[model samples]
Target: MDYTAQILKNPIFKIVGEAADEMQVETYVIGGFVRDILLKRPSKDIDFVCVGSGIALAKTVASRLGNARVNVFKNFGTAMISYKDWELEFVGARRESYRKESRKPIVEDGTLEDDQNRRDFTINALAIGLSKHNFGKLIDSFDGLKDLKRKTLRTPLDPDVTFSDDPLRMMRAIRFATQLHFDIEPDTFDGIVKNADRIKIVSKERIADELNKIILADKPSYGFKLLFHSGLLKLIFPEMVDLHGVDIIDGKGHKDNFYHTLQVLDNTADRSKYLWLRWAAILHDIAKPATKRFDKKAGWTFHGHEDKGARMVPKIFRKLKLPLNDKMDYVQKLVRLHLRPIALVKENITDTAIRRLLFEAGDDIEDLMKLCKADVTSKNDVKVKKYLSNFKKVEKKMREVEEKDRVRNFQPPITGDEIIEAFNLRPGRVIGEIKEEIKEAILEGKIRNDKQEAWNYMLEVAQKKGVELN
Candidate 1:
């Protein structure tokens, strides 16, 4: 099909065409940009594959664009240029062969068809010609347009060869399916399962990157489910795989934490787009397997799982090469406190409890609430309704307490220096004790969170401790 009208609209295409003609080489805009255009997904980055030296084509294109700076990667036969908020990447068309032990391909310059054949999926193999003779004519040797119409993902070449060459493609396959809400072809899906172990040859950072993309999808559970079925999760993230399965004793059983976790993840994804929050959902009950217990009275108890799960977050992040900074800490805090708000909703909702929660969660209070709401995954409709109603009440109370107490990220009105002055004491344990008492009194509603009340309370505490102020 001719997309010449569409291609001509972008001035860069003309520049690229002229550059290719000048260099006496054929070039085409290929891969993701073409795939997204067919799927009606907006994309800004374009990939250009040239039958000759891609670096040369890039240099010519850059010079034609008034010497726009081009970043060249000689080792990869690739170059990139940024123009008009669009990133255009150029690569030489190449064929690849892989060894059994590794996923790295032996690359050699080839024709445009060879490059298309090397693509991971049919949809991604679509290309738009940039030659003056066939400007904007689509090159689809693998019927990528048909796959786009059917909402299916299939490798451009044989599935085994495709996945074996680069095991990361398995992850990419699942990610694409999740992002587009499409189905993997049955043969391709089976191929992923057979080649699941090949993923271990890939780097953890690359695996985590793909996992993050899958988590960001509209219904992320789809990707996780595929990963689980394909055995990739067991290889890459066994802790998550450990969450699978249900056990029974004396005809008593508990819900599968794995499925429940996925439900929570999907629920969170629907409500919020924050990556860390979705991670919190994924890890909210991660320690259930480790902490699982069964008693005659209680069929199953994952008591303290939240705390254990929180402790597990950092190790998991380090292993996956995820950021070990505040992002990890944020996910850890959410995992630890995930059950607190829900417990309050179930019990007597108190202002003091709300104040403490608000104070602890601080700026993340809203996200924590969103996570708690998403955690409501009862199969019983009536129970779900009851839980939601109670949550609404708890939320309303939290708001009221937050407004009155202003305790979120709140600091004690009485400072350590103020305590030392009021109690006629030096910087010692006595001053710290007084400060703690005053802060607790305010949080517990025994005294107003104001300087006057705190000062009076401080004096009372000192007097009780037999420390008279001069």
Candidate 2:
């Protein structure tokens, strides 16, 4: 098929074709750039495969395009050019062979067909010609266009061989399936299941990168289900795997936390496109397995799951090689407070409770509310409606409380320095105690979060503590 019109729209393809003609090497635009073009998805990264030296082709193209900087990787026989907003990568058509012990491939220059054979999936193997004679002619030897139209993910070659060559393809398969809303061909999916253990050879950084893409997809639950069924989830994240199954004790059963968590993740994805909020949904009930217990009367209970799950966030982040930063802390905080708003549903919600939640969640209160709402994965429409309705009331109370008390991210109106100086005392436990009392009062709605109110309350407490003013 000719994509000449579409290919010609980008001036770079012409420059590359001219450069390839000058260098007398066959060059073509291949891989994701072509796939996305046909799918009508926007893409800025373009990969070019040439029969000869890709670095030389890149340099020739760069020189013609006002001599843009060409970053060359000698060992990999590849080069990259940054022109305007586009990233143009040049690589020689090469075939790869991997050893059993590592994912790093043994590489040697080959033809365009050899390069296509090495691609992870059929849709990605599609290429468009950029040479003078064959300009815009597609080279789809694997029927990738048919697979794309069918919304099916399939390996270019034998699924086993394609996966065994590089196990990271397993994650990429699921990631692409999730991103494109496609299904993995049965054989291709079975290949992932068969070679699931091979994923261990891939580094955590690459795995985490793929996982993040899946999480940020329109529906992350699908990718996670694929991962769980393929047995990759257990290998990469055993703790989450432990959340699976229903433990029935004497006709009492708890929900399947693993699937519930997936629902929460999907719910959060619909509400917000933020990654960390989705992470919060994933970990909110992580400790349920650890904290699970049963009583004859009360049935199953994960009593301290929230608090325990909060502590598990850092450890999970470390194990997954995720950044141990404020992002992790944000997820942890949401996990800890997920149940607070729900608890308010059963009773007359108070302004003091709202104040405390606002103070603790700070600017993340909205995100926390989102995670909490997503946590409602009940199949019972009535129950879900009741819980969500109560949340709206809670949010309304929070706004009223915040406007009245100004308590979000609450700061102490009375400083410890003021207390110590007023009491004519040095820095000691008494100063800290005095400050704590004032903070508690502000959060409890006993004080207005006002300087004068806090000052008056501080003096009254100091007098009661038998600490006379100087």
Candidate 3:
């Protein structure tokens, strides 16, 4: 199929074509740009490969445009030019060979066919000629159009060689499948399983980047299951793998936390597009394996797993190379409080309970509720209905309590400094005690969230503590 009409509409391609003609070199719009054009996916980044000096061609193009800036990476022999909202990358056609110890490829200038042969997947190997003589011509040496039509993922070369050369491609394979909702060709999948161990050589940061992409897919669970089955998950993220399997003692078996976590992830994905909230769902029950216990009456118990999981979030983020900023703290807080809303659902919830949840969860209370609701993955339809109905009630109660108390992310009406000044005391444990008491009084609904009432309560507490109140 000809994409000439569609591509010609964009003046950038014509400018590049003119620049290539001036340089008297063969150039083609290749890789993801070609793939996405055929798939009708919106793409802003454009890649072009030429048989001549890509750096020199980039400089010519930038000079011709007169407005775009060329960013050159001399080490990699690639240059990029930004035009409007689009990024155009130029690279000389080159062949690559890898050593067993690293994925960094030894590069040597070669023909366009050699460059296409080195592509990670067939679908990405398609190219569109960008010269006056062959402008808009489709070049598909590996029948990439067929794979695109079949919605299949396969390497242009041997899958074993492709994955072994760069095991990160295994993650890329699954990531592409997940993003495009395609299936990995069986042989390609087998390569992933065989070379799963090679993923260890890749940096944790790279693995984390791929994992985040998978997590952001339309149905993240599909990618995760593929990761688990391919054994890649075991090598890259053993903590999640440990959540697999079910152990039974005396006819009692808890649900597989691994699959359950995936379900929660999908559920959260459906509710919100926030990546960190989805992360919270994945880690909500992470400590189940560590906290697992059996009792004759209780059947199975994961006591304090939420607390343990919260504490584990930072360590896991540090290991996985995820951002340890507010995003990590957000995930940790959700993991810790995931059970609080459910507890309210299962019991006779009070305003005090809702207030504490709001205060602790702060502005994240909505996300926490979404996580708790997703956690209710029961096979019994009736049980699921009951839990959902109870959750609605809890939500209603939270709204009412929030409207009246205004306790979400609320600071105590009385400050520690005020308490110290009133009591004529230095910074001491007594000041902190008074602040806690004031916050508790507001949360417990024993006093209005007003400065006068809080000041009076502070004085009363000091009197009770046998300190003279000014």
Give the lowest summed-lDDT range of ten residues in model 3: 1-10
User: What tens-digit string does per-residue lDDT give for candidate 3 at 341-440?
Assistant: 8888856788999899999999999898888888888889999999989999998998999889889879888887777778788898888888999899
Listing every candidate in turn, what is its Cα RMSD in Å to the true structure after a full C-alpha superposition? 2.0, 1.5, 1.3
lDDT of 1 by residue, 162-188 (tens): 998899999999999999999999999
Provide the overall lDDT of each model, using Cα atoms, as 2-decimal numbers: 0.90, 0.93, 0.92
Q: Which candidate number has the best TM-score?
A: 3
Q: Return whichever of 1 and 2 wins on TM-score.
A: 2
The positional error of residue 61 in candidate 1, measured at the CA in angstroms, is 1.6
Task: List the candidate numbers ranked by lDDT, top first.
Answer: 2, 3, 1
Decoy 1 TM-score against native: 0.94
Candidate 2 residue-wise lDDT at 193: 95
So what's the TM-score on candidate 3?
Answer: 0.97
